[model samples]
Target: MGKDFRAIFWKDIRMLVSGKFFLLAMGALALYTLYVNFGYVRLVELSMYKVCLWDPQGICVDGSLLLQRASSREELDRMLLEDPDGVGIDLSRGKAEFLLYRSTPQVERYLEDYARSLLRPQEDFKAEVLGAFTTEEKQRREITCELLFFELSAVGFLGIAAVLFREKGMGVLRVHACLPVRGRLFLLSKLAVFLLSDLCFAILLTLLNVGVGPGLAILPDVLVETVILSLFMALIGLCCALFLQDFRQFTMIYLVIAVFVATPVFLSANTSVKAGWILFHPFYHLYMGMKNAFFGTPGESFFYYAGAAVGIGLLYMLTAAAFSREMRDAPGGLRYAGKDVEKREEG
Candidate 1:
């Protein structure tokens, strides 16, 4: 059994290598590391929004050093027109009137407070830190968590499916139907391979982006969450590939999942957008679990792990049933699903 599993593992690894899975993973890791360390953090630091003022009567005495002065009301209008995100100050009525684009309530409140603070710098507002991370650590953990979620949900899902689809195209999976190894092992082997790859990706990504000591401190818990997420996503990819007709349909379905399903999870998790249903969104918990693991605060409730296990089990069973059906109903005299694809393509 062990030997059979190892053979499948090696075979899948070769397939993944030919598919350039490892290369893609490395490229993504390097790209994300560079982006978090060099780009995103600095961008956050400079997010003190540009304040534009058109105060002809000089009703506002204290102007901020960060403020950009405007000569006329038209100039202020032009600034706000060109950069709607920039806060505009209109003092034509002898009082500072803020003109800015409509945003979320939280953002609007922040912008209004910021504009008022700039006009009166002596009115200092103090804040108390609730969390213990430095800015760099917070950003590192944040970006790392998001990248891991993306890799597992998007990249890792595609990688496993691509390998399985290759097997399906070449009729290799059909051959496995006649093999002595258990049917589940075939699926398990692919999951195992991708799981290892994702875990490796998680480790290096954490270390490179979040600093060695901090990342290592949380590595064990991170790997635990990684395993849960990898299994869940790999099972989903397997079921999707097994049940979907072809890569074209798979592409459409993936877009639905990636854009619609995943986007809201990101928005609700990272932003202040409150959704009453986010608590029921499974991926949101998975994302938060990975994030908490990175921060050494595993906030996974009882329902998260339980729900994850049930989901994985259901997906696995569905994939197994679909796998059996595909084998049993393979086109007559043809070994694989895509044996006649070339003829169809030519037509």
Candidate 2:
């Protein structure tokens, strides 16, 4: 069993190399690191909200550096009209008045709180420290977590499926059926290869974006989460590839997974686009786990691990059953006459 596993593992690794999966991962690592360092981190570090002020009477002190003085009320109105997202302050009266375009009552309330907070920068307000990580560290962890989630859920998931489709196209699965190795182990080898690749990516991504010190500190937990997500995604990839007719079908399914499935996971996780049901989204939990690990926080509660374990077990069982069925249906590439595709000759 050990030898068989090793052989299959090495074969899968070679296949991955042949497919240039490693090169793609390296490219993704560099792109993500560059974006984090040069683009995303800097974009996040910029001012939270642009404040346009029309305070002619000097009623409000210029507490925020982001606050820009408008020449008159007409100017402030024009600015608000041009940039509806920009919060406008009309303090022509002695009392400071916050003006904003009509929006949801909840959003309006949030904008009001934000605008008030900006106006009182010198107030002695103490923030409850959630973790030892600084603002920049938090931002790094955030973008890193999001990118890692995307890599596994979309890229890595499709990678395994694509590899399997190639084997199917070449009819290699037909040969594997008669091999001494158990069908599950055959699947396991592929899963192991993908899991290993994803783990290495996780390590480098954390270190590169989150910095060495913080990344190393949370490496263990991050790896645990990575293993969980990797296994689930790889198995799912196998299931889809084995069952789906061809790559064309898989492409459509891939669209659903990447766009529809992952879209809400990101929107609900990052922004205030509240969806009450995200509490039950598995990817949300996984994403949060990755994010928490980067920030040196514990996200693996009993429920979290329990759900992950159950999910992995279920997916493995399903993949094994599907794989066995696939092998039993066609044990060899040999077929007689036009009934089977394997035995046709003289083409």
Candidate 3:
């Protein structure tokens, strides 16, 4: 069993190499690392809201350095005009009055609060710090987690499906039915190959973007989440490839999963966008599980792990059924039969 599994595993590795799966994964890693280090972190830095003050009598003292002084009322108006988002203070009458371009009530309230915080910088208006991560480190981890989720859910899914589709196209699966190896070994081999690839990817992605020391501390949890997600997605891809008639059908389903299904999870998790329905979405929990792992806060619920284990088991059974059906119904069976006839005639 071990020898046969090893052979099947190496065969799948060769198939992946021929399809450039490793190369594409390395390319994705490079692209994500570059974006995190050079683009996302710099662009997402927390810039304070611009606050313009026109204190003609200089009544306000010890204001935050974030405040921009407006020499006159006209200059303050001009500043607010140039920067529509900027909050202006008209202290010319010796009493503070907030001024700004009209906006939604919620935004106006937030702008007022921000301006007030600047006025009283000495007060503890900031939210309590939870972790010791710096602003840049936080941004790095956030984007890294997002990228890793995308890679596992979308890219890894596609990779496995593509490999299986290629094998199907080349009549390799039909040939497997006549081999001495058990059918389940074929499925397990593919799962093992992709699972290992994904784990390696998760490790490198974490260590490279999240820093070696910090990423190492959280890697065990992260890899645990990675294993669950990787196996689930690979089995899904396998079942899809086996059951669908062709790549075109699979592409349509893939788009629906990647766009409609995954989009809501991202919005609800990353942005302030809220949806009560998202709580029931399985992928949302999977994404959050991976995210919490990166942040060093693994989910403590036994039910979550139990549900994941049950889900994977069901998917494996479904994949095995699909594999058997495909093998029995494949057109390659006839071609192999004809080859057998030719060999018998030569004998």
Task: Show how many residue pairs clash in every candidate, following the order shown.
Answer: 0, 0, 0
TM-score against native, each model: 0.78, 0.84, 0.82
Tens digits of per-residue lDDT for model 3, 23-104: 9999999999988888888776676568999998988797888889999989999999988878998888988799978565
Residue 174 lDDT (model 1) = 67
- Candidate 2: residue 264 lDDT (0-100): 88
Stretches > 4 Å off in candidate 1: 43-102, 106-126, 332-347
> Highest TM-score among the candidates is held by which one?
2
- Displacement of residue 93 (Cα, Å) in model 2 is 5.6
Q: Against the unseen true structure, what C-alpha lDDT does each candidate score?
A: 0.84, 0.83, 0.89
Candidate 3 global CA lDDT score: 0.89
Question: lDDT tens string, model 2, 173-287?
Answer: 8788887778878898998899989999999999999899878988998899899999989999999988887789999999998888788888877776868898888988888
If the candidates were sorted by their lDDT against the true structure, best first, what order would they fall in? Answer: 3, 1, 2
RMSD in Å for all candidates: 4.6, 3.7, 4.8
lDDT of 1 by residue, 1-347 (tens): 99999998898899989989899899999999889989988777634577898888877776667778899988988888887888998888887788886467767878877887787776673223458998778888888899889989998988887777767777766677787888878888998899989989999998988889988999999999999999999988988888876677889989999999999999998987868998888888888888889889997888778888888888889999988887766432253444577667889
What C-alpha lDDT does candidate 1 achieve relative to the native structure?
0.84
Most accurate candidate by lDDT: 3
